[model samples]
Target: MATTNNIDNKRYQGLIISIALFLSLIGALLAFTFYTSSLLERNTALIDQTNQVANSAQAVIKDLFDLESSYGEDISSPHIQRVLTRLEENTALITNSLSAIEQGGVITDNLGNRYQLPNISNDARLDVAEAKEQWNVLEPKIQTYLKDANNIMVSSADELAQAVDQAKTSSLFINESLDKLTRDVFSNAERQATTIRLIQVLGVAAIFAYFLIFVFFFVRRLRETDAEALAARRETQEIMQTVNTGLFLLDKDLKIGQQHSRALNKIVGEENLAGENFTNVLRGRISDKDLNTTKQFIEQLYNPRVKEKLVDSLNPLTKVLLHNTSGTGSDSRFLDFKFSRVYEDKDIARILVNVNDVSDAVYLEQRLEKERSQNDMQIEMLTTILNVKPKVIHEFISNTKAHIEKMNNILKNPGSSQYELEAKLKAIYRDMHSLKGDASALKLHSFTKIASDAEDKLSALQNQGALSGNDFLQLAVHLDDLLSLSNTIEMLGERINQTSAASTKAAHTTPTATAAGVRAAGAIDSTPQANSQVIGSLDFDEGEDIDLDDESDSHLLAYYQDFAQDIASRQGKEVQLNSATLEQVQIPERLKKTVKEISIQLVRNAIVHGIEPPTDRRSAGKPSTGNISLEMQSVGQDFIVSLQDDGQGIDYDSIRQKLVELGRFSLEEAEQLDRNQLLKQLFSSGFSTKDEADEDGGRGVGLDIIKTQVKESNGKLNVNSELGEMTRFVITLPKAS
Candidate 1:
């Protein structure tokens, strides 16, 4: 197509050139013709002027001769009257011819009629002036003769004779001058005729040359166009036959082009699809929905309002699935369809459609998806074995079981009282939080997923300030999933345990050397020149008096101290944990559990939420390591567990915003809320200042669970914080009776 268009363009340019040449030739011919015609007209005028001069000269001469003869024959005859009139006419003619000779042509007026005289060439002007001089002398003689002849007297005969003689002499001189002037006029006319003929010949020759050149160019262009058309036809046939992909063109009306790949028939399951509407050919192969969608898509592709690529995603034929009906068996195949605009000149002339079979690719993707699921399961198992401690896993399973039992017991309670229901929701929230925390700590995503979902519903119940038994029943699905997963994980745990035990036994059995032999090998060789020496030794004083701080009494504090420091380190902060001695004050076993849980929760919360990192603390002109203190004491009937942190205090605005995010109140209402109300919402489930959920914090369930635990022990929890100064949580539990 491109070659053919190039040939056509060349032919068009050649035609324009030929037209221009032809116009130039015509213009030249017209100019020469006009010039030749003017020359011929001038020649004809000169010839006529010469002829008139000659005739006038002859007339004057004839009239003078007759007058002289008449005067000789009869001096007083009546013939003189006729001769005088004839001479006067001839005289007027001679005068006009003389003027014509002086002016170079027959003079004409604005009306194109001859004036008083014909114009003659100025080259003969001198001759015409001399003739006029001669005529001037002859005219008076003829007039005197005419006057004498008219008297009719014998005495006037001699006067007539004298007049006739003078007239005859002047007439001879006039005749000679007229002849000279006529010859010069004839010479000039001949030269003008020759010029006209030469111009005529040259103009004809030039026109012939222009004609020949135009014909040559025209024929050459025609031949080139034919050759280009033939070449294009051959190339197009080769492309149509050899290309494997289904390629075709569609016009604005969606009619397929005449030439298409042989593969098109196999792809579309149609033969001889050329000249047919593309939509019709596709209708039987693809669903009607796709057909309509494809029609609109192609229509949009033809729009010039935006770039084609911008709307490429709207193409419906992309990855279109078509059934392969050519084969004997009934099966489906996916064909990839693509479209692009074909431009002719600067306009889009057609849309090119390309189809390819992608069934193998589609099937491969399906298989890959199945394998990916299997890989995910294997990875989950590997993670469980690597990261989770057996002890944590065991405890998680046991605790989850107990929590589920507690939830079941709450559901089993038949009381429909709103207050009782609210209490049950609070209890359920604590149990779910504890389970979620254990799952999160152990990195068991499956358990955490189920527990977090249940926690969400229980939180909604707490927000309602009431709940029904049906609400508890709604939670059964999550609980069931958790229970089922727990059993599966417990079995896996047993298998893991068995594998560990076998590995330990195999290691013990594989050992060959005794303890003494190993020690001797480890002991520096004391042989001569050995390069090993013992640098350190163990010392024991078994009989010496010993004094050691009672670690048992401070174990709870120490464990939490270590926990705080570790959490701070992981978060890139430094922290110092200080605790008052609580060994002297007796704590009951149940109260001890409460204190320990509260201390662990508060300590972690302080480090995660309150304490700034070392950089922040130093920037604030404070110690690099934050300070966290745990103090326990009893006052009358209340046992106080106070936890304080010398770090950033609670931001009440942040708490308000969290409440606003949970949709409990608008931002305006939240801001208007009192500080006490804002602090109280810290115990609201799923309300945390942290933006993301992670293993350490941001679940917001810690304080809520702690509040539940305090309530169960008949205690009160109080929070006090000064911005940028300190944050403290005071827990007061009733002393055991």
Candidate 2:
């Protein structure tokens, strides 16, 4: 690995160097090209300037010649004056053009931008001065001739001819000097062009040499690296194919390696497992919670601060049971997972995971453990049977069966209307609480465990104050489990009785109570006193009646009132519940369960969320005790149940803000929602004003479940609230079929 890493580092460094060199060469070539192009433009511009100056000089000479030719002709004085004016304009143009060539000034460019041109060479400057001197000497002579020509009557035509001859001679000298200046500019432009071309060629040659050197080195390194990589790949392939255990590598991002063992796919129940996130692959196999924990565990393994051994206990994938989806659901397999860090030069390179299927061994171990537990339980049961009175065992079983019946009745016959959820909750809590206490008194360990679990669920519901119809429905599963165990114990008791009857009948023993007790005590030899203590706890003489099917005659409204009073006393507050007669309203048995669930939830919500304590009421100048009222009646085909409490009403503004906070609506949308729309949010799941979950309120589910039950029964839930006044929920349900 070290050797491979060194080779890789060297190759990477070489690649970087090659790229830098190539970029440098290209940069140099570009700089040279821009410089050469600039030089070429300047040289061309200078040559053109020289030519323009020469043309201007020739224009002056041509005008002088025309003036000289017109002097000899019988031209009028006006025509002579015009010729002289043309001659002077041409002379001035030549002088200005020459001065511009000597001293740089603004010239219009192709883009109509003014750009300054540089001064010409010294030789061109000297030529311009000579031409200017010659023009000065000839200008006065021409003007004097023009004066003579205008006075054709006083002056002879010879003076005009003499002036023209002098002007022509000066023009010739200026033209000769301009011509020499133009040749010098052209010769210099040619030399500069040659130099620019030569520099460009040299630059290209240097770039080519640099590129060739890089290519030769890069190719040699690439070939060497490829050969080494090919050999390593072949070796890795052989190992991957032969390995029995599921082996795979994970990179820094926890992505599976491209070259993983074939067994890895089978273990994880996926094909083409490579390149996929390891967590995602396991998602279908393990629970999301476990998958997250597994990811954390793997991450911890990679943490430099944490020791691998220290995090071994945190490994969530260790001995995880995975259900084989590829087969029948019954096929569950346990996988033993192991992780190791693959290091390159003392740094973590990748993580290696090894999965070994331990399904058979785990299954065997579990079977042995279960058999041992069963053997011990059976022995304990026999000992308890021999020690305790037969009546007590029968009584315990009977009591448990009665409790189970009560639970089923609670589910089947829900008390109160759907709007009085609190009443139903109180009733359910009483039932489950009674069952737990009775089971504990009897010391039925297995029965108590199941019963205790059920009681705990009821307590959770009470604490959360978020009761739903489905919440009660969920209890049926635990009830069934408890009933199943009850039936098992009943069967066991029957078998014990038969065995006792057979032994007694065979011996024909007339056993006295005292002797029977003595024999029972002797069976629990080590704790004879404890055995007597267990039997002595129950009164055998006074037979306890067990009525499994008994239904209470309590009115729903009265029960809620009593329940509210009881809760008020517990809370150290005073509250009164007033209600209209619900007896006349016939609630269908089909809707009873839903109605019961909703009623319990709503009543609890009222006392916990809507009703204020006595002190708060007194401070508000109301009565010391608060009042909660429930009214239910049948109207046409609908049954309407309404409940109200004189307490702090719903905070519409708070609800609106909450809606925005929860992302259910934007701030603008929430603000636009009227009182009616905002009140509907109270029935939304997970919506509540309470900060903490308690038996009375919070847990946000009460109103939600009430609404759901009402809707399921083809009913409608409506809310009305005035801040600092009263809050009411009126539910209207269609009469059940």
Candidate 3:
């Protein structure tokens, strides 16, 4: 076995030597590779420097040539002539403009270097001047010798070279040593040929040995690495699929590229967006645009002059682009799209377009906008409601419908006469006038606007004024609008009723016939004076209602006597009632009921109880008559009513004495009370100072009843009395709202 092992060892020696040689070759090759890479990097850098220098020099030469060309081109424009003339006339102004332009007044462009702008800055203008001066001096001369220009240029070059050579000692690039260095660097590859060949021979030997060992292990490891790479690619794809936003990948051609999410696929499939052009996609799914615009945006990719975003094709506001992923609209809920540039240099260069569906977010945003508009309208409605008196506004709605109901009445009785037409128009005018006053009082601008227009039309018709075709057309349209507004008020009023609980407003309050009578009776200024042409122009005749009664057959005395006799007969007692001013009283329409009720009550009370019997009146040295008088007067903001009787005056001392006897007040308190306070006891609710004794009638609530009734009519009541003489009550109530 030992001898066999020895033979085996000898046979393997050659293999071992081969392995050693292979390992040695690997180290040699790696070092050579590193050295070659460094040399290549240096060469690349030098080449880049040479290119930059050439490009810069070429740009300067081109700029100068452009300047010369531009100067030649602008010789005839009006603006160019103007600028030239001005420059010639005022060189100092141009100098000042130049100074202002030169002093750091420019914005640096994208590369952080200033390109003095053409219109406003000094550099462009300076170039213009320089170009102009040279061209002005030489252009005309050069044009004359055009064929011989090239020959002249060649001669000029020879002369220039000789002149430069004359100053050789001062030349920048022409020294002997510098010339040699430049030549070596730029021109001589063969100069180092032998040395380079030796290096190459050594390098080849080393590399051959090294590659043997390197390839064996490298090939083995490559298989394992490739397996890991496949696994990583699978993981990346899985992550993209699992991300929260819906995704739609697009190709550079802008077709429905690819979809990862179920939701995204459904939208595209439902919309038929897969093969449609992007701009015309508005037809199918409303990607909502021109396809060419979308394509153009995608084409920009990441052109730096614009935004440095991948979506060069679309608004960055609504869309975005990422290398492999993009989202649009709400970040949390994307309705946006992205176009990404990936690996542009390789054949794999592609646009990875992404889309995110933001339907719910967009819907919510629209809903909010709609709600805002509604809220603004609601505020306007509330402002309108605030402008009107609640009662008038309510009536406007309720009464307008009633007034419109009259239209049906007119329709039923449709008769046309010039006179009847005038009456019908006047009725319409009354309603319109009421509308105008109510609208004006409320400062309701919209309501007044509609009502005034209706009124003017009616007024024109009523007065037999001309109604041109346009006027009638406008009137019909306007009246329709007013009628529509009336219905709106009714609808709004219904809403108001639903929301408000405490209002005394009835549905409609119309003008009463009695109220019209009141206007007729009280407004005597409408009566014509004999000499006056216009009736109602005279001031009110105050003496007209006055009656110092004379004849018993007269209206004034007959009314008084009849009223008194009725009281006396009703009470089974004699009562003499007189009006210092009865027929003289100009009764308002609203005051008719109130005046009658108050007058009768006062006279009856005096006849029944306020007086003694007729015998007592006679004994008191008065006629056997219980005398009462009524007077009326108009005062500021109110009408005053006075009722006076000389039957038996109210006894104030008795009232104070009774208040003390009752448990309501102390004798000391009664003693301190004034006469007015004592008299007020008679008007107290329950406890009366006067009782139903000594053949007189009292229920203990007479004055209280009087006070209650007066207060109910929104009136104030007070009494003044003199013992055994006259007693009087004064009442006042408002005449208007």
Candidate 4:
């Protein structure tokens, strides 16, 4: 403030000085003008006096010659007297004018206006004194001539001639002196005029120099101020460039300021962002919704009534996903934008925007979240494995491993054409769907979720316009996850079996109980082939030779019963499995896996699709518990496995509606199809009556699996359904050699 005051004081002082100088210049100009006017007046007067004196001297010479000529003319003539009188008057005028020229006195013109004439220069005075002396000498002769001519007209001619000669010589000398005096006076006036002009020129140059000096100082001060401002701006630019965060100013119009941080370019993957509209900058980078919200948020910042902190949570740009298209390719980034109001005094002027690239941080956070979810899933899986029966878990793990292996093989040879790729996808989808169903039955939710996710991927691939090898690349990642999960479950299953074995050995109980415990443990530890061998040991190949009371056969029936009950409980239905017929007849070792696979799929399909919920059953005046019967028989060289469920039978109308809904067939075409054709449609891959797929039967892959299994086994499948009565599937396979 003191410095400012000092500068102000200096400015005031300069202004005062300038004013004084200007006034002095005006005064000097006035004085010079007055002086020049006075000099011109005096010079005019002197030249007028000089010209009058020269005119008077010439008149005297002419009058003197006229007097002598009058003497030669008639002496008695009146012209002679008139000439003498005019000569006396002219002589008197020349004497008075020369006297005025020689000294400072008033002179009169022909108009009788008197003017004061200053004393002449030395040269003019000398000429004036010589002219006066000649006039003094000539005046007496002129007077004598006038007296003589008036007295005697016929007097001595010689005397008259002598007087004339004296008058002529005197007159000639006086006129010569008067002419020299006139030249001298005019020369002096010219010299004085030149000197005055020189002075005026010098005064003008001095004023111009002063003005130039004032301008130089004023401009210098301005340059200093500009330098300070420029230095400050340079410093600001350096800070802006050095900062990592994108920084800029936004006005109320949503336009960016002229100056912005250099990092703004790098963060936004753009250049020359200055002066661009803020919305245009963020337009393509963010969603339209976020961009509009950001605009409003910034406008709010410019409002003083809106507390900046209160609206901070409403910032839509916080962790915004921006797709930057300014680079060679589109790059996605997560950016955080913060706005602060720039206040000038009490009013908000601009909004300061700070943008930061939070992609890495957000990505890291997402990865951490994923890891936590995966850990929770693993824990849930471990808990599930512990609660499940060892035999069931063992069988589930083996079947899952087989399905995953098949999927991996399918992925390995994705084929070249679109048709071939789609076929591979459907094959993998069937395997994944089957795996999902089994996992859902065992309550291994982690496995079921993975399988379901994989099925979704395959379904997407199947729906695409065309398929390529690259299209299946993402599926490989999902397969790896499934493979990893299966391995973890297998490890958990082995550990549980070992722990159970240890607990059984430590109990030291009865031999029978111990053997049962050993058998259960052995089943879990057994490989897929080993488990099949154990089933083959039952030897229930032919209907007459089977033992109904065999413990292994009972375990097989119990397995199916438990599986059916678990699926019913999940679907909110009540089911009672009657495997009495199945106990009487069993399949060969070669058909054990096929029969198990077929039975599991058929049982889930019945509980999920065929069985009505308990409330519905009660409302229909039927028992709340739905009945499912399993039976196996051998006819000649073929063994038949059958599964029947007594619930709401197959709804062919629902199948037809689903066909029309899926765009597979028009309504007229579907209505014209018979029951067998509808069933054939139901068995097709990717066909489902269910609107949405869950962990269970909605995938439509269950029946496809049964169809594939029967085909591979070189068997026949028969389906029978009585609406609202029952639905049954019979599978016939040639008896193993």
lDDT, candidates in the order shown: 0.71, 0.68, 0.49, 0.78
Among all candidates shown, the one with the greatest TM-score: 4
For 278-352, candidate 1 gives per-residue lDDT tens digits of: 887677678899999888888887887758897778888777777654564335668888899887766778999
* Candidate that scores best on lDDT: 4
- What candidate 1 gets wrong by more than 4 Å, as runs, is 1-388, 397-440, 443-492, 501-604, 627-644, 653-673, 685-716, 730-737
For model 2, the stretches where C-alpha displacement exceeds 4 angstroms are: 1-11, 67-93, 100-163, 228-261, 272-439, 452-737
For model 4, residues 199-272, the per-residue Cα lDDT tens digits are 88888888888878878886787788689889999999999989999999988888889888888887888777
Better of 1 and 3 by lDDT: 1
Residue 524 CA error for candidate 2 (Å)?
Answer: 20
Each candidate's number of clashing pairs is 9, 13, 12, 0
Q: For model 3, what is the alpha-carbon lDDT of residue 223?
A: 68
Q: Mind giving the per-residue lDDT tens digits that candidate 2 earns over 1-737?
A: 79978877786996997788778878987887887676666656656665665675566456656766665555566776676676666555555556666676555434675545556678767876776677677666666665655554765456557666776687678677777777876776677778878877887888788778878987888888799889988888989888878998898798998888877766666777879988777776778899889888888877877887788877888789886665632356799999988878868788888998888888899999989866665565555555455544555566567767866876777545554555565555545544443343334455556655665576577657555677788788888877776676666756655554444343334346655675677753323344334444221222234332232213466556655765566566677888765544556545555565566666667777777777888888878777888777778888777889898888888888777876779998988998767767777655677766444445455676676667768888888888889988889888855
TM-scores, all models, native as reference: 0.46, 0.49, 0.26, 0.53
Ranking by lDDT: 4, 1, 2, 3
For model 3, residues 222-316, the per-residue Cα lDDT tens digits are 66667777898678667655766545554555565443554554333333445544444323233334334556676566343545343443454
Better of 1 and 2 by TM-score: 2
State model 3's lDDT: 0.49
